[model samples]
Target chain A: MYHDNYEEDDLAAEVELVTSAQYPQDADVDDGFDSEGVVSSQKQPIAVEIPDTIKNFITYFHRNVLENNIYELHTLYEVTFNKLTDRFYAKQPWPEAELISPLVDDDQVFLTLYRELYYRHIYARLSPSIQDRFHSYENYCDLFNYILNSDFPVNLELPNQWLWDIIDEFIYQFQSFCNCRNRIKNRSEEEIALLRDNPQIWSCYSVLNVLYSLIQKSRINEQLLVNKNGGDMLEAAGEYGSRPLYKMLGYFSIIGLLRVHCLLGDYTLALKMMDNIELNKKALFSRVIPCHVTTYYYVGFSYLMMRRYADAIRAFSTVLTFIQRTKQYHTRSYQFDQIAKKCDQMYALLAMCIALCPTRLDENIHNHLREKYGDQLAKMQKGEDSISVYEDLFQYACPKFISPNGPNFDDPASLSQVNEPYQHHAKIFLSDIHNQTMIPTLRSFLKLYTTMSIDKLAAFLEMDADELRTQLLMFKQRSRQQKWITGNLLEGDIVSTSDLDFCIKQDMIHIAESKVGRRYGDWFLRNITRFQDVIATLEHKN
Target chain B: MAQLAMNRPEVIQSLIDGVDRYNPDNISILEEYLATQCQNEEYDLMANLAALKLYQFNPHLTNDRVIINILAKALTAVPAPDFNLCLYLLTEPMIIDESIKQLTALHQLLEQSRYAKFWETYKSDSAYEQLVSEVRGFSRAIRSIVARVVSMTHQQIASSLLESYLDLSGDDFAAFVKEQNWELKGAIVQIPVNKDNEAKTVVIRENIKFEQLTKVIGYSNEM
Candidate 1:
């Protein structure tokens, strides 16, 4: 049901009309209108006031019927448009098509555009069968084309501020509808390329405005897989010196963009975005709109994927602290319950990160872990040979930890799909723990002596001297990378002779540096500081 | 005297009137008659009302799947049924009918503690207005579920947040807390753990522990 009037012939006739002498081009007329439509500078700028009827309709719309009531708004637009047209036609016989100035003012046109965009959104959500009969998208396209072809002044602002807001929302919704339809239809690359590459169909400002709107609305999830078409548009905006535009979109948009990257499995890009946000935190978080806890969670998750344990821990800890602080007020609410569940997952992940990092759990956390997972912690501490404990923890925690409030928590298939990455991480943690079993044994052995013979040490460890040496060498390498280790195990000669002496002497064994202990202290202190920072931020805001 | 021929509409009307009067015996007689007249066109609404009356008579009957089964049947009936009652029945935990998957999605949304999403979906879909009107206590049931989950952790919570969460006003929330016998301190609602509830909580924990243990054992056997 799309109207078939927007033919190439019609476009050509419209172009001819604009260039014809009926509309004289003034010196002020700019060629920049070529991309939009033909513009004719007004000889006398008309002070057209929005009629009281349309103004009242707008006020009623803003107060009672907007985003939440689409069908009502649609009906309102139809009735008002007919009434206005009927009144105009009754007052004066319809003028010749070329001589008729715009039937409605800019405010009315903007409302029409808003209603069309809402219809497009509703149509997008409809099933394909019903959508086949719905020409919302085509109708919207035709309206835009009409606006471009007609001599509607493109520069005049709509009368109301709410109208501007609706325009922003409309642009975002239009692009989102197009993007969603493209995916559902699985449009060919050529078709998508035509949509994106064509400056007429897709402009840099439109795409940037949509992106900015999505961020401001805190809808990063919708941004996933949708930004591919806007890639070049974003580049063009940057090239066109749209720094102020980007700034107005603000840091929350950057966080949203970062989350989009994370959802798209581009951890590196997400981390880079996080760095950008961090560099401008004072400007970003200082705004009235505070950063979402989910942003921090995604950032932490991205860092976790990159195996940046310390950063991951910090990010997850921040999320947990934020959740805890907010939960106090609405502890009996479902939102708080969901947040608390998320905090549990974050806590689990933080514990896993600590396990993988060059850190030990502090007494408080260790006790908490023991209480939470008494048997599993005991098994890990005892250096068990079986993988059952780790596997159990992974099995028990991964599904919930991955998506604690996922809709399909009870669906095995969806749960598995959501938990895949978490399971992979769990496996990596398990393997890492398996390899580090020797470190704990070595720590225990070192507690007994400042020095020991290499043969005896190997015997105590139930391994060959070469094997023990290799393990010690791994520890030395790790220590070199992380300064938590105090000293390295240096091999030396016990006697001043030509013969090489291989003995685990005091210097050879080197008092096993309490790296784990030091790391634990550092981690605990950092966590406390982060917790305080979150509390301080929340308290300061209040 | 001729025996009264109880038709489907009369049975439904009687059930409704009985529920209004708290006359369970009259409801029981109507429900028994409804069972024989199940093939009647108006049986779905009648059956749903009967189930709802039973549930209201004893709130603990909310867990009975049989009540849900009757409601689910009513949902699939030919004539237009009271969808609100069907929706309320579907919200009961452990409803397992494939025909009511959309209702199940709503249930799962609530089950997963996505209260905001559930309410948004509920409000956005005008089709649910009938259900919203018919099932008067459904929203309260949802609020109770949320309250139960939240009470598992916190002993006291801000009443203002509770008001917003439950879609109640300040006075209404205070009245609700008082009605529930919960202690109110200024704007804070102190949700006390009932001794009976604590025992039920223990049972739930035990059940979860048993399930996890079985799962672990099953995994070990596979290995």
Candidate 2:
């Protein structure tokens, strides 16, 4: 827990103290900043007076690495590295706090040291195996949180960077370590304890959480831009500082808000939240340059919730332009492709909603919907009698709108902006639509079968087709001699005196002769014929 | 085991329909009277009709296992019950087919073992043992019939069972077919023969094995 004693005024005082301590003669302090605003000790760069050997080593290390606080590692570098660098890193003769003043945030410096000390204690308690990965930012944060919350034994304060080192080690080796026999195959008590005690164990999943947050934020920012007033507000605010801040914060809030609304069955709130982005769109553009394209698609979705056909179509069409552009590149921004597909799906659903409307006004709307959603619109018109209401709905709802095997928006450029998992949700959404009267049973089955492979079908039925086929054959052979044919079953009973007659009468012969579904249907007919032959032979013998 | 006429499918169906007309206690006597009265009448008609009616409610209820279990419970209190009477009462189309094959197999086993009247007593232990010994291959055959029935449509199964039944009797089996009027069966296509030429016709006998039958069917008989 962080201490509450350091107020804003106290921070201002500390900053003034640091600035005054650093610049004694130049009292030309700006009116905007308080006297204690700057920390002076940290302002001093590492001195150049150190020996060439020491300076060279420090220079090589700096060149090889991204800039990070060095005081944490300075002591070790000084003691071991003096032979190489000739300059001492952290002499330890000076107070450690004073030595680290340059790197540490004044208010948080003591707290940071306390947390580091706690993590070291936790790390010391862990087994040697766990200790190996106890290096990195993530590991430090996890270990710090654990030690601070619990009573782990150890006496010294650990540097925050050292704590982070543990976490960094854990992350870099996480996947390979998990794959090892000691981690997965032979899950010893030590490994279990490591998992239970180590907070960094969950950090791997935290990356996905971060990604989701960024995506949500991106989406919200775009939505907020649509509204003229909200857009203006963001633009005006962004002029003074970072433009992406307000938009990112606004969008980050949408995922949780939308999720809660969805769970509460508050369709109105969900619709409004989705619609709000567009309502405040102008403000978003002035603030954030990289807004999520899915905002336009979801706005159309909100229109769908309201059952507003024309408006939904207009909103969705805007998203289509982005969809076309995003596909031109070989790889897309991770969420950009998702946004495009979502637009297409929303368009499809809008078509369905229009088709479902029971009004003469929807005639033009229905035609538009049918153009996209209907399988064979002209045929339905030609044979009006064949068109059932449910079939029309099936055509309109369009179960096959979302293609699972379609191209993905997976480019490093887009993904680099945010970190979120792109676990496609379209299939689940489509399945739900299928279940909720979007398509009739047979059509849905056909669509599902077309979308998924035969292998997947086996999983759905909970039986491998190859195994089932074998069982069926064995069953047929066993019943071959039985004279009694059940009235409940068709194949066992002879339909006609002649084999040709039976085949023709049952339409089996016609099916066999046809090239349609030649492989699957033909295979079925062959099996049926084999069984019939066995039945006929047994009857003759009897 | 004795068969309970009250539990007979026809009587039970009637009981279900005439819930207000017949007292639950009088069901046993009423069923017995009806069964006794209908003994001389055609069983196939009454049993098939009752089964077809019950089947409309839930097709799987007419399954062999389901029907057999019902019949077995009905016959629990009776001694030396007739299998034919039990079959008629239960009226499960699949069970009728299954029982016929089982009975024929039992007869074949008895005839082979030189004891033709083995199932005459029909006590629980004796009947179970007799059935077990006589038809060692019963379960497999029964299971296949059940599976075949499950696979086929109702009409296909009905026609197949009817055709198989005719074949079992073996005397101008087509007569039994003609008697049924082929209501349960689908359309049958007959190839027309020219009357101008005298052709030597070969009747494909029931004794032909599968391979031989296949070979025979394969040959185009010229007229």
lDDT of 1 by residue, A301-358 (tens): 6555544555566666655554545655546432354455556665665655554453
Candidate 2 accuracy as lDDT: 0.32
- Model 1 CA lDDT for position A485: 17
lDDT of each residue in A1-542, candidate 2, tens digit only: 11123223232233212323432232221222111123211222333222333323333333222233344344433233333222243211111233333223432434344334333322222222333334324444543443333343222333232332333223323322322212222344464455446543423234224323433433444444434344555443343112233234334345333332222222233443443433333533212212334344444554443334344455555445444445554143322443444544654655444332211223444454466556543333233332343244334332121111101123324322321111112222222223223112212232232133334434554667443222222222221121113321000222211111101122111111111122444454457568767977898999
Evaluated against the true chain A, what TM-score does chain A of model 2 have?
0.29
Distance from true position, residue A121, model 2, in Å?
32
lDDT of each: 0.41, 0.32
Give fnat for candidate 1: 0.00
Model 2 chain A: worst 10 consecutive residues (lDDT sum): A496-505
Give the lDDT of residue B50 in candidate 2.
33
lDDT at position A231, candidate 2: 57
TM-score of each: 0.34, 0.24
Q: Which ranges of candidate 1 are over 4 A from the true structure?
A: A1-61, A64-249, A263-265, A279-292, A330-334, A358-378, A385-434, A479-508, A512-542, B1-223
Query: Cα miss at A441, model 1 (Å)?
Result: 4.2
